[model samples]
Target: MQKSLSSLMIALAFASATAPQAHAASNEDVVKRHFASLVAGPTPKTSELQMFLTMMPKGGDLHHHYSGAIYAEQYLEWVDKQGFCVNKTDFRINTAAGAKSASCVSGKDLVADNAAYRALLQKWSTADFYNHSSGKQLPPDQTFFDTFGYFNDVASTNGSEGLQTLKKRAIAENLSYIETIYEIAPITPDGDFDKLAAEGFDNARLNAALEALVPKLEASQAFQQGIQNYLAHLQKASAGVDDEQFTMRYQPFVLRFLPPSMVFSQMLASFKLAKTSPQIVGVNIVGQESLNVSMRDYSLHMQMFKFLKAKYPDVKMALHAGELALGVVPPEGLKFHIQEAVNVAGANRIGHGIDIAHESNALAIMKTMRERRIPVEVNLTSNEFILGVKGPAHPLDLYRKYGVPFVISTDDAGVTRHNLSNEYVLFATRYKTDYAEVKKLSYDSIRYSFLADADKKRLLQQLDSRFSKFEADIARALLPAK
Candidate 1:
């Protein structure tokens, strides 16, 4: 509905610019002048900027999370459809036995009671965290991650349905592509590897351990079945999602906090899957980077990534590194994440990177990102909410100063209660960016995407057309009558 209205507005602008449609240059000049006017001051017109960015052709969301992109309301609807019951106290998916008891409520019945429904929404998401913070609630970061747990039961169940919602929403906002962290790669545990990892194996020993473990995992029925199940899941989730206008691709990730063997095995499976599946463009490692488990295994995770990259040679990674802040972890922990993610993991892209300022030799890291043309996936809303890093405190300016490329992204739009457009608004307003730089961010999204060379070129050309049309429409709307 909104998208149709926007198109109509753009058409009206086109008409207002000129009837003959021959004054393309004049219309473009008018649009550029108008945009410059909006962005002239130390403080850009934020509300107008929001409207402008909403219609801009954002190339892709490379750091998106499939489950996190889903809103809580949609999950509630699924709960009702799937006949799942919600626990009244914790807002969890209740068991059949528990559902029959007074402790649980049917989704249908819960909706009738408005208070319960609203409370459930808050608990299930970051919705009105302030209103309910008087009660027992987790910290914002904890709350954000916890939302997934509350809905994980039904999260993957309606993959195609969830994907459809995301697609419609993306198109509504004029976004052309999304490469989402769709799901985790399945794993079969390795007892031997686990023992060695806990005892702390050096790099060589770790490699040797993997050498021994690879065949064991390959021969194991459980591991092979995991791969098949993962592929089947992807097939079902992405069925009929693509068309001429928009595209969606998957990034099967491994969680950082898992056992060393589990992480390696999952990474292996995902990298292996990438070798075959065109839909699965890349792999990522994700989780709260500050957790004890995550911090301890950080180096090993990069090594695992490096090993997989060498073996597959074609698999790409956009690792979640430097996602921490000063107080989130010890100083030592901050020093090497982004560095290793780039130098060791051979990450094609970096996600979050909010802690770049605190990283040791931060200039060097930025230099590497710049030199290699590796773009950082900057998630404004996610960083602010999760790490309390925003405005001048953010490392965005540093990256810019050092010439490190970046792409604005939505790390967890549903959890953060913002869209990719809002992210652009935040970034532009915060940095006081002019229209030209803002447009570059849009183009950078496609350029840094893990899509095939052909796909990237195709999308870039589409962006060119989109920007031209958008600028013309805006020009017409801003033109004055004689």
Candidate 2:
């Protein structure tokens, strides 16, 4: 791992040093040169780069997760206030319904017990686990996926407050938009439907089954009621998030680990929401993609996506395909996830196209993405923590080499304990990306977002203005005096 990382670092250093410098339009160009100095050659100044990134005009976080973006600290702040407490041993929050449990510790008292409080924070996030070896750490993948369970109940307890906090943080970083996987649609099992769906992977047969079954699923009162509840939850969570400087949108998703019938039910509901809801911009499928259910039904899920997208042609889609690494799954499993996502499912955008190189037709996939302008949402921190794929071994440069559009994102900032600014720092320094491509990435975020054309134009214009002001201010304030 260390050897591969060194090679990657060397690759970045060479690119930054030898790559043509971005041309400046006029003389008051101190900011551009300053940005270059921090990222070029060996030993790039990561601290200064992070500071510069914080002031940069990032257009949007196109691959954010609602539950994972809000930090555990924020959740803890609401715990005692909401009449909740934490379990001293397991660290799960006791929701109102579970308030009567005597086994749990109050939030206030947990904080008072600094040691346990610190431990809870660790379990809730990736902090300290990387640097230290002990403390009952699960494997990285397990630890990452398990965090949602630890805080799931409290994460959504007060969606409005969480949304506000997310907004304030984004504005502070000068980001103008966020396309978050806020929540998923509800699902109910159809044992009979599952039995039929499980019988085969023949696309025609599955489509026929779905075609026969969806009307009944849609007509059912429980499914309709679930959709109503989802809309209400979204409306409440989205209250007051958008303003003159910031905008937010949702991509209701489905957990792919569920049974075929349930996955289809959820995706159906999510696509329905995407077609009609102004704030719900797209649909996505999310889960640990390496799990048995996810891997076994991988193609099935893609076919499910293919089926729904045809039904709701207006609804946009961004599937989380190929979040795998070698040895984590069988070698064969890595070969076709991203290809099927783009070709079979017709993904508008792909989140964490991490296993791109493993695909049988990797170059062909890149070519298709370039032609279609389908952007891959790259999450440096999340990838590093979850897949241990970073530095030169990461496929970011491969995507760049193929002219494929991509955007930097914070997949689960709260869990990874980093923000978009930090992601930019990682991208810039590791790839030795100069200010110009970095600037283009910022624009790409807005360009690839599943927002309406009008909202995209509005945010793009705002980003342009924000960039001009940010550069001018940095030049005036930080430019070295002659």
Error of 1 at 318 (Å): 0.2
Residue range 1-482, candidate 1, lDDT tens digits: 99999999999998887787574567657766777777777778878988988988899999999899998888888887777788877789864643545667777777778888888877777888766566577788998888888988988889999999999999999999999999889888888899998898888998899889899999999999999999998898888889988999999989889899899999989988898799999999999899999998899989988887988988888999999888888788889999999999999999989888878888888888899998889998888888889999998988888999999999989876789999988987788677778888899899999999999999999999999999878877887654
For all candidates in order, the CA lDDT equals 0.87, 0.88
Where in model 2 is the C-alpha error above 4 Å? 1-28, 96-103, 478-482
Summed backbone clashes in each candidate are 0, 1
Superposition-based RMSD of candidate 2 using all C-alpha atoms, in angstroms: 10.3
lDDT of 2 at 287: 97
lDDT (Cα, tens digit) per residue for candidate 2, span 105-164: 777777778888888888888878867677577898899999999888777779899999
